[model samples]
Target: MGVYDKMGKVTKATRSRAEEIVDYVASKGYKLTRIWGMGSSGSEHPTGRALDFMITGPGLGMVVGNLIASYLWKNRKRLGVKWVIWDEHIRSTSPGKSGRWEDYRGASKHEDHVHVFFGTGAYVAPPVAGGGGGSAVKVVDLSQLIEAAERDTDRKQGGTTPGAADDVKIVEAALKAEGLLSARYARDGSFGSLTVKAYSKWQESKAGGSYRGKDSDGIPGRKSLERLGKRNGFKVRS
Candidate 1:
């Protein structure tokens, strides 16, 4: 068996899951900057159930990092993903806390990679589809998007609204494409002051020039969102 993070043999399940993650990233046309498995003694790493895939790409890597996190979360049960950490936050498959991205108090902010832990059930590797499929266009929910944005704005610093990361990330991706938001902050799934400022700039642009003053207050309006969706590959659902 191959060495696990230069320590020793990892469980079949852990090995399979780690391979799948790497393959998945490759299929998306991006590469993981680095991967670590089975090191820390008290953690899942030593037990061979944890893996850390450092993210890097065209722009500081956060975009693909977000994509990987989203994919793992979406397929948590199917892939036996027990827990995940990225960008200073954690999400778990545990009851009452599933899908909730809460602040991570750990020393590592995890901004540069995605840390995943799989349950024992991930023994047999799932079939990994091949080829570089560009980023998938997510279907954005307008109500949830607005709610998430408003809730995020209430925060004094970086934080995400519950159940809002995916949708917010989609919106942020659109904003980034418009050159309004920096890639570094675009994929973290937060709609803080920076996102608000970016959205305002988007509204003032020619494409959304119809909005003015209160209408262009940075909270995405139906028309402006629709227009953005048209240009971005996402569909806005009301």
Candidate 2:
């Protein structure tokens, strides 16, 4: 059967971008079990600019949901995507800040579905400033980072000793850059629960179309850490 077979009856209308997203997913041989296009007042769904792919499958449903989210983020410009929310995380294609998967603390955690919003205008890339000489890229030790996180039971504000959480600070800064952690907690240098949760979300964003529960265990892994470092102008030494 085709992808439409899995989609239940849709009561409300949808925009072109939402339809394109469904077509793209179907082209990739993926199935979206259920979809809802209408919402109550003050929602984009009623205006046909938003849709919720109520995905249900084996495991946490994060596998297929992440695939859809990542695809939408990567080709957002062409797809006219405003933002994507799934599994308690949200990524926006905003003007200045794009591709930062922040922790979504909305009313709905969106643990079981992937929500997408489309913009009316064409996607515009943020202006990049000119620079002459490039500075040295910072390096973080993954081993030390994992060790600190493992022993970070206090989950407090700062570190006990000076520079004790330096490596963690580096990673936290990266996470903040990705919008996963807020600025208030970005430089605390503590691998606490919040930081762990943010890192776990980051881990879940990768691997194309696979569920990554083990990798998203809030522990730092080499491959995922390296990817983060590469994106944020840092080097990871394991």
C-alpha RMSD of each candidate structure in angstroms: 17.9, 16.6
Q: What is the TM-score of each candidate against the true structure?
A: 0.48, 0.42
* Candidate 1: Cα lDDT at 189: 85
User: Native-vs-model 2 lDDT?
Assistant: 0.67
Alpha-carbon deviation at 33 in model 2, angstroms:
46
RMSD versus native structure for model 2? 16.6
Q: After aligning candidate 1 to the native by TM-score, how far in Å is the CA of 155 from where it should be?
A: 65
* Per-residue C-alpha lDDT of model 1 across residues 1-238, encoded as one tens digit per residue: 2223443366755655555566577778876655777665446787777877767545438878898899889878767888899999999987788579999988788988788888876342232233475445457888887887788888757688888788888888677656577656877888888998899888888876667798778888888898887766677888
Top candidate, metric lDDT:
1
Model 1 / residue 83 / CA error / Å: 0.9
Per-residue lDDT for 75-141 in model 2, tens only?
7776578889988989988778657988999999888878888776532211122256534557788
Candidate 1: pairs in clash:
none
Candidates' C-alpha lDDT: 0.74, 0.67
- Which candidate leads in TM-score? 1
Counting clashing residue pairs in each candidate, in order, gives 0, 0
| Candidate 1 wrong stretches, greater than 4 Å | 1-8, 56-60, 124-238
